[model samples]
Target: MDVQIVHEIFFMASLIFFGGMVGGAIAQKFELPDVVLYLLVGILLGPYGMNVLNVANGSLTVKLILTVGTSFILYLGGREVKIRVIKRVWVTIFLLSTIGVLISTFIVGYTSHLLLGIPFSIALLLGAIISPTDPATLVPIFKQYKIKKKVAQTVSSESAFNDAVGSVLFFTFLNVITSGHLSLEHSFVLFLKDTSFGIGIGLLIGIFGTVLISQSDYGFLKNFSPIMSIFVAITSYLVAESLGGSGFMASFVSGMVCGNKVYIGMKCNLENRKVQETVNETTGLILRMMIFIVLGTMIDFNIIFNHFWINLFIIFIFMFVARPLTIFTSTLPDGRADWHWNEMLFMCWVRETGVMPAALTGMLMGMNIPYLSHIVGIAFMTIIITLLVQATTTNIVADKLGLIDK
Candidate 1:
């Protein structure tokens, strides 16, 4: 509306487009994940580095972009999930996403509280914030390395599911910490409602979307099928959120339904498939670039440096101790899916935090929670370390484990 605001918007858009193009290309040339390049570019141009692109942390615009961008990433991740695979391994995925997240959260939370002398509430909040693995970071590794199909699917699906779980947990704990009034019973009810309603809305819309695409064969309808899928994703997310549901879960389910059923129905139409893949990939790339770049801009070196040792300690514990404990415990029960030691180890190490944690940290900062700086510093460090360590080394791990395709 205001002239300055319009100019700022235009400037940010231009920077993201041109910067992403250059950074993405360079990352590909070096065989690195584009996320790394995007983040570095963000830091270089952002307030922390050059002060060239002054996007304020926790601003309304940043929050909106993150919300939409993360929803899109989750939807894309879900679309790649195969229903057949889920049926066979749903128990494993469920245990990994839910029980696994809880275990990681408590382990990290209790340790932080005891070691750092922070309140148990704040420590729990931190644990919840960083618990979920990011699908956006892992998708590239899976695609680039041609990792074993089952392993990739498990990781991707678990990432998507746990993001929703982690988000719900984060907000629940945030409310408990801030207000100190919510009962466990009430929180459980809220969790149930969020999950169930989200699934309901997603299934309904997904079915509607599938029918919409499948029953239409007009040239214009076929041409716009990809756009239509995106429309469904955004609409489903908004609708679910407005009704007090988990928008992330809803968008994921909608995308999964549309991708597997509706998209598959068009198998006979090669042109349609190509158009869908091209458009979806392009859109996903742009969103990821924008998200990571914005994430880079939010980092404050002062906070990170102030708590450097603790941050490093947290990352080490999360990667080496907490994650392994959760994965091993969750998969140990009888009748759970049996996985090889290599697969289990790979799963433990694939715990990279990404956009969701960044978004949650921004939201918490906006809330002005106590010990905010420490929480944010730990989160930022966890993200950087995990991406640097886990994401970059995924292919190597797969190769060592003989999980990479020949």
Candidate 2:
């Protein structure tokens, strides 16, 4: 890369980071999730608003920022889903993330095909692209709100795990579109391959991380607990991807293991957990801000507005019809979870389309695939609409549903 490009990169990074901090401040003052403001800040600095930074969509810098930022955030999300709590709802979580994503994809796909006249395969691809709810968006909202434990954990955990399912389905369908083959058995095998390796690798690394820093006799590296968390996250993610697994799943699984050291039978005498937490908090903040800001800058208003009515109508079905059907169908059958209507309703309202979908669309941006512009437009619009509507109203809805913890 040339010096000018390098300089531009640093300059853009600085603006994004600084803008994030400011957005965070404003978010706090109004008691809102910071993601909304981070996106707005990005729009402010991006080509549409100020014509400041014309950072090309799917550029290396954009990809790199999103890749690193989302992985770390996902790891943090995994940490929040305690094994003890998850066990009670494991079946629900599993079905919700896996089968639930598939269900969602089909609902949105068929609905869009009939309504917008989009080709069935392309519509299915669109559904797959947006099926996974974003954990980066959820974790912060959970932290800010005091939703009931079961509801919160289920939603957050679903967001973390479904990214794997969503990705596999997207690729599988993409293959279908290109090659005109839809193999159910192949899809199942592919999903298994990615998740198994991802969780397997994560388990090994999480165990390794725990032993390295646990206050056990062998924990010579205990002093660097904070730094080790970073090492663990990045290593798990890269290793899983290297092995053709879901890197996001690996990161989340590793995070779960790291957070609950007792589950791993480690005598974590790490007295510096507080400091480790501080580091993670700061790091997550920076990442969350950058992810959304970059998403903001990537928007193409011309395409978005060109198909404004059709895209908006699709989003309407996406948020309401498809999501509710998917959630109720997935959750109601899990007799073990015995979900309350309100809790299920809260889960229904809280599925914010965010970083995962944004990243998937970004990956597709460079391709000359049919309906690519529509895909990009709808995906980004989903991000904006969900963040603005569902995310912002979370507290109010939680309070209304009486799902709040307090």
Candidate 3:
């Protein structure tokens, strides 16, 4: 709004963007995950260090940048979800996204209370916020690690869908903690409503988007294809939000259907690696970089340090227990009974949670919701650690465990 803030926003955005490019290039050169370097850039500019870049209120500039960036990233993440692959591993995906999240939330929540002396409600909120892996930060390594098809599908499916599940649970729990009137009956009713409505909204959008593309002439639509998809994604999110459904799920489903839907006489033209699909992948790439950079600059390390141990414990559980249990259980149906322990281990620690939940947590905190800051701060810390630790060593771990092909 102010002239000074505008100048500051440009300056900060440029710095982060340039930093991300350098970090990304180096990470790729070294074969380390780029996400780790993005986060390292975040740490350098966050409150713990120079504090040159910060996420604050009263700025539409940052919000606009992040909103578009996040939407495009979510859509790209959604595009990665292949329905046919998921169908084979649907059982595993469902269990991990729903039950796995439930288990991790309770584990982290109860453990936080025991370990951090926090109230039960605060601990539970933290559990819900950081329960699911974020796909934006996972897909890069999914390609690098060359994990089995089933394992990769399961991880992507769960990551794509679990955000909606975790979000519903987070808000439901928040209602209970804030209002103190969340009965079992009320909770079940809310859960059913959220899940049903969210899925319905997403399905409807997916079907609509698919039909739109199918009926159009690709010959005439090439230039407009990207814009059309963006339109569909944004409208789906807004519609779902208006109806109190999960907009995140809606955007994802729309992209999923768009990615997999067959159009009459459409052909794959890989002449340009960036524009191979029916949708424009270049826009997706731009959005991904923008979102992660903006998100990186948003990290408030001071707040994280205030509650470092609590964050670490949550991260530990996710890395060592919840994710592994979900991946291993998901792989069971593939009939790969003789699992490579190292491959499984690499898959377990492959991905980390990221910007969406952090953004939601920040929103909740701004609303004066109790314990919101603690939950958000903890989630950010866990994301940073997960990206830095897991991304840096996933390849080494895979090789040491003899999972990599010679």
lDDT winner among the candidates?
A: 2
User: Rank order by lDDT, top first?
Assistant: 2, 1, 3
Error of 3 at 226 (Å): 1.2
lDDT tens digits, residues 25-108, model 1?
Answer: 998998888898888888898887887777777788888888888788878887878877767677788888899999989888
Residue range 223-285, candidate 2, lDDT tens digits: 898898889889999999999987877888899888888776777654678788889988888
Counting clashing residue pairs in each candidate, in order, gives: 0, 2, 0
TM-score of each: 0.94, 0.94, 0.85
Cα lDDT for residue 249, model 3? 66
Instruction: Output the lDDT of residue 319, model 3.
Output: 68
Off by over 4 Å in 3: 1-5, 57-67, 215-223, 263-280, 328-343, 401-406
For 136-248, candidate 3 gives per-residue lDDT tens digits of 76676767777566666667777777776777787787777777875778876877776677667766876665554443553444444556678767877788778876666
Candidate 2 Cα lDDT to native: 0.84
Number of the top TM-score candidate? 2
